[model samples]
Target: MVAVVTALVLLVFIASFRFYARFLGRRIFADEEPGFVTPAHELEDGRDFVPTKRPVLFGHHFTSIAGAAPIIGPCVAAYWGWLPALVWVVLGTVFMGAVHDYGALVVSVREKGRSIADVAAKVVSGRVRLMFLCFIMVLSWLVLAVFAMAIAGLFMAVPTSVLPVNIAIVVALVIGWLLYVKKLPPLLPSLVALVVLYVFVWVGTKVPLDLADTGLDKDQVNLTWILALFAYSAVASLLPVWLLLQPRDYVNSHQLVVGLGLLFLGIFVAHPSFDAPAVRMSGDDAPSMFPFLFVTIACGAISGFHGLVASGTTSKQLDKLEDARMIGYGSMLGEGALALASTMAAVAGIGLVGFCALPGQGPVEDLSWAVYYDNWAHASGNKAAAFVLGGGAFLQQLGISAVLAQTLMAVLVISFASTTLDTATRIERFIIAEIGDALKVKALQNPYVATMIAVLPAIVLATMRVADGDGGVREAAWALWPVFGASNQMIASLTLLVLALYFWQRRRPVLPLVIPMVFVMGVTMFSLVLHLLAFWAEENWLLLGLTVVLSSLILWMSAESLGLFVRLLRERRAAREA
Candidate 1:
């Protein structure tokens, strides 16, 4: 609809403003003191620190932030009432998401590209850093496990999916080898590999998965696969970037950009109306609106996880101080755009003439209607009517079936889930190594040993839970949402604290620090409480126990922070301490 066109334009404008404010407006600071060149600035090399073009960084950042969360959250949250989900996504991204992401990257760059945990150590103490690291490790484990199962589930769903993914991985490996080992031109090989991968996807659908009389339990087998997958992830991450990480990201980034463009084009041409009811129909089974909704949709609006990506991977690569704004702010806006695309997809099925009004459920419930009980835009007449309304304009122009277009949309959702699994696994392995090294356990420090130690628990938990008929790993995935949200927020809180530290040392304005710091802390703690309660209610005593342990660590650190803040404030009052 033209209505959606206006929304898209507005988002682009807001995103552009955020990018400019972050980078180009570096001269227009609220206040400034001495020019402080942090380690990242001092250690700049063109390899990592080369100034990235905004468009290139846009692709990089967008692919980094864009993942299953945006897709899955929108699809599920749409069941709530698209309006709330829509509002939260659009408004929340502009204010909270962009601010959190952009600020984190900028702050990390200022601190010489130290990770959030490292920053916390400097701002707080070595003990706090250790605690933060441990918290992150545990959370990373959950993220890896959840995504592992998710990717496997996607593979199982399509039956033929294995072929496409396998081919893509192989193509990536070939490209990696040629580029790194043989010193081949990266761009050409990457392009050729991607084309090969796409052809394989089409061919893959032709091959059968032998589903008939298959004896394996999908859930049980999936859990086992997740464990085995982590073992591989451990090995992969421990190796140099030329081996796996950089190559995959490079190929995946191109794929992501191309795929996203195609999907957007399909949507533009299809002109699907919002068919689902704007309101979500609720039942007694639904959890309390407050906690459930907040947890269900963590990454789309604002994720603490974004802080980790910003501070850990991206910050270290900043070529210039100004690049922080473009890479940070602009990337987040891309994520918001993806969220908006999902929201619009959900809304597309609404309000079609001659569409026999059926009760709309699933993703459409949230945006178009206020209450769950209202009339919804059903898919039947909705698609047909849009086709008629467009008078063959869009279809004739795009030359794509609306239904095939929808399938492509779904594929993108699954791809995000798959890519996230790979990324999450790599990160978790690093966390495991860090924890193991800290504990000074030789066996634990061994990559294989640590990976097995980390993966087994999740596999058993996923399997046993599934065997017990609780939807297995799928249900356990729910338990993970809050923990992921909190851990990410905790990272954000730490990042902001670093910014505050830099300002404090430089004798600059402290109000900016106070605002974000307070809000993130509140949201983080609230999320932690909700997660703990959910674990206890589910009678997941093991996780419940782990939650208690982690909470104790986080609370102790938080209390320590408060004490430090108070002492600092008092010290400032006593003497204008910079």
Candidate 2:
């Protein structure tokens, strides 16, 4: 079943890229002028607007948006079943997610590489531009919390991954120096850096850096790591793109592909059967799979964050109009594949008997799908560990040692999360600076100041203590995920709205954009409403507060966009009558 499912997904991805993506680039976007110049050429700054080749830019874009969410979302969503998660990932990416990305890239490029938020000023209204910026900033804020929490938890669970993950930064730094400063061909240096990174994976096991050893309890240790991770994000954001961010992502891009290849190969070799049921719709503790599944698996399917990475950074370096299809649409396909692998990792029963303790429970003597996913909280909470351990078991079938296979999988997870962490923080810095210029706040316009503002709020959120069930307190990092996912889907839906409005104004065929727009918007709204009520019921004031603020933004901007859409229709009717 594992091999069959994996092969089927690969086939679908290939067909979509070859046919569907080509149709979008040529027909919908209508890129007749193959020689059309892009922002990378028009505003050729060495720092942000470098006219990058398709392959290199694809690497940057893929790794940036492919972050921990794709891996974690699908695996966690498997709390319901792999069938729902897999179907959403495969179908959603092809129709909605890829199109959303491709459209955002095209529109932002047409608007001279300004972010989609900035572009929203023209698409809807100036008021909407500000609203969109704030919405994106807040989403980026939640994003920082979610990914930081994920990385911190993974580090705690997979202590052997700690050392290699840090050293990957140093390795990336060297790769950047070689490519940008020393002017070397990228392939050789990138391959060497990747090799160096895995060698450190072995070394990491021998010298694992466990934060618990530093006299802090588990929660304290998680907070400590979040703080440290934010510090790194600050620096990564402020640094020039070519120096650390781009080259680091390049290394990780290769690292991700290699890791994923080995994982699937192992799955084929082991041919593990599914341990979890296909359709799991009922559990007293489970949220409704209808909307929850969509939000839970946002990134690999359709993510607003992908649009952010699309317009926020990727569009700036787009070398030409035609490249948008591959960079924008193709990368989402890559993430979908990542998400698919994560789902398989969660469902396969390759290592069925290992014992691991869940929250509020001792180690289960006979670990399996039932034990690992005994409830919603544990399934979602330990998502990274589930992927690492599950993927490691797959690799062990390929003759890798238990420790090494687990460490390798850990390296894969950390590498994915870290690249996204770098990109998201940089994007948030960009948003803060843009907001500063709009508001005429000189301090906020400063990059250093913007980076600080970007990092701090998330630090507070990631470190906050929330009252958990059973009269105990817990770190609020991962707890932010529910709000984060809802906010994520909301943004995706809004991006679709922006795209739908863009096409409607131009009087182009808007069905392709409208269908997904409506579906994702409905899903986002449904999830947010349900979450608001549940949060209020549980007295989860933090989550409730966040849901209220974000829901308001979604509703407000949606109203504004709808008004514009209606007005545009009236204008068309009047013109026809005249």
Candidate 3:
């Protein structure tokens, strides 16, 4: 009954959002302009600007944006309750995330496919552009660092996932060759490739490969996997989109759809009741639900990163103006659906395997809802492990073996993270090049040099250490996650501001853009302040400095944009009177 109700609610929200997106596209963006030249057509290059079919472009955009964050965030945020997470996922996607993504795409298309930061230069000021670019660079660094570590962790934690993940890459290369070089039809070949991927999944379960078994210590294993993943990113980032990026994402997109379908189906068949509390409040030390929930569940509901992908890549490949609504707005709703599934799994499935004690916390005699939430809130890695276990439980409901189900779930997570890491690297490469051009540095314009510049910081950060709860140390990824959430939502707010400015310049009603902008700004800023205080108390100077810098940039950019928007509005009024 719970599963049926959840499914119905999600379906209704998704259907309604689709219709609303159409209305916004038609009325707000006027996206139906006939024969408007798209950047793909105007600047068709074999590399990045090639005109793409709607399905292919949507796959690329969705997979790139719908990475491990959506799954990871909601899984952790379910600590507050499934109800809150679900509500935010649905409403945020419909009202905030979709609008941010759609508007960014429209603005970028109008600006010949430049990034939102680039668009900021013309709409806001040159200083705003520089700040926005710096903001994006930092955001990308966090994304790359977090996701690369995530994939490495998954590979180590679920060793059976390694072979399948590697095999999928090889299969993507084959599919890319068929689709681009041989001009083979995509559907049949993609279907075959998916089948091959699953075959590897089954084989991997039979022969799991653990890196620690190869005579390396824990630290050495972590370092090795991190280095291996970034190496893969470097090469993958440099390759042509048709060769690896597009086809690989296309494959992963299918995997996501299939995974979601199975999850929902298993829920319906198993009829798992919600065991976690509908809402839980921890002690005074815990973060409150107001702004923290919004920031904590950042990507599941709304992500500023979606705006980057929309403007950075998707706009350039749009086949038609109308497709912007489908690709941009639609992908966000798709991500919301993923977030919804993750929340359901965490609340319901995790109950099947009673909650365990968090790191540095001794084993409990019995696990309760309060203990579960408390443990997860304290140990980020525990939340990730809990999600994997919960997702595996969902798969087991379909009569799959427990080991196989867990491996499959890990594979799904790794695949999502890998795609995001490589795509972000490529996007960062472009950003680095753009920054170089802004600074008038000729050497940094080369893609290879730019890509190296983009990846090095992430490598350095991922390998950095923070004190582990067990009196040891762990990679900085988990420690950096809170900052990532604040930064991510801040990016979304800045994007909304840019879109609002776009509407204002064109004399369109700015209410749609402005409302979400104000709400997100409030939520993100509040959370940032809380994080700043927390980091200060803990004497974590690095994250403390990051929080301060990000807060300052957001304030600076917002002030400049607001002043310019008012002047623009007044000038427009004066011109109309004349």
Best by lDDT: 2
RMSD from true fold, candidate 3: 2.2
The alpha-carbon deviation from the true structure for residue 410 of candidate 3, after best TM-score superposition, in angstroms, is 0.7
TM-scores, all models, native as reference: 0.78, 0.96, 0.95
How do the residues 1-578 of candidate 2 rate in per-residue lDDT, one tens digit apiece? 87899999989998999999888777677655667888889998888788776777888999999888888888788889779888999989999999999999999888888998888888888888888899889888878887888788879877899998998888888888888789998889989988898889999889988989989998789878999999999999878788888888888899899999998898889888888899898588888898899988989899999999989888888887888888888999999889888888888842443765543355666667777888887777666556777888888888888889888987888888888898999999889988987788999988899999999988887877787645777667666677788788778888888888887777677788889988988988988899888878888887788779889988999999989889988999999999
Tens digits of per-residue lDDT for model 3, 1-578: 55876777678667866688877887789899998999989998888887887887888899999888998888778778778888888888888998898899988998898999999998888889888988899889989998988888788778899999999889999989999899987888888888889889999999998999989987789889999999999999888888888888888888878988888887888888887777876456567788888988888888999988888878888888888988888888888888887888778876665444433354655544345566544534465665676777788889998888888888888887888888898889888888888899978889999988889999988999876444666667678788889889989988998898888777677788898889999988888888888878777777788879989999999999989888987888899999
TM value for model 1: 0.78
Which residue pairs show collisions in model 2? none
Residue 321 of model 3 has an lDDT of 87
lDDT of the candidates, in the order given: 0.57, 0.85, 0.83
Sort order, lDDT high to low: 2, 3, 1
lDDT of 1 by residue, 1-578 (tens): 53465356456548555564544234322212346454444765533333333443444456656776675566456556667667677655665676677777766676676667767777878788778778876766666666666556555544555566655556766766787579786678778877876666556667735333267775555655565566656555555534554566566667766765654665666666555556665555554445455445567777766777776556655555666666766666667766666655444532322222222333342333222223222321121122222221222336654333323333455556555555555455545665666667677666566656666665554444422125344345435555666666666665566556655655666555556667766767777787777777777776677778877887877887777878887987889655
Q: How many Å off is the CA of 100 in candidate 2?
A: 0.9
Worst 10 residues of 1 by lDDT: 380-389
Going through the candidates in the order shown, the clash numbers are: 24, 0, 0
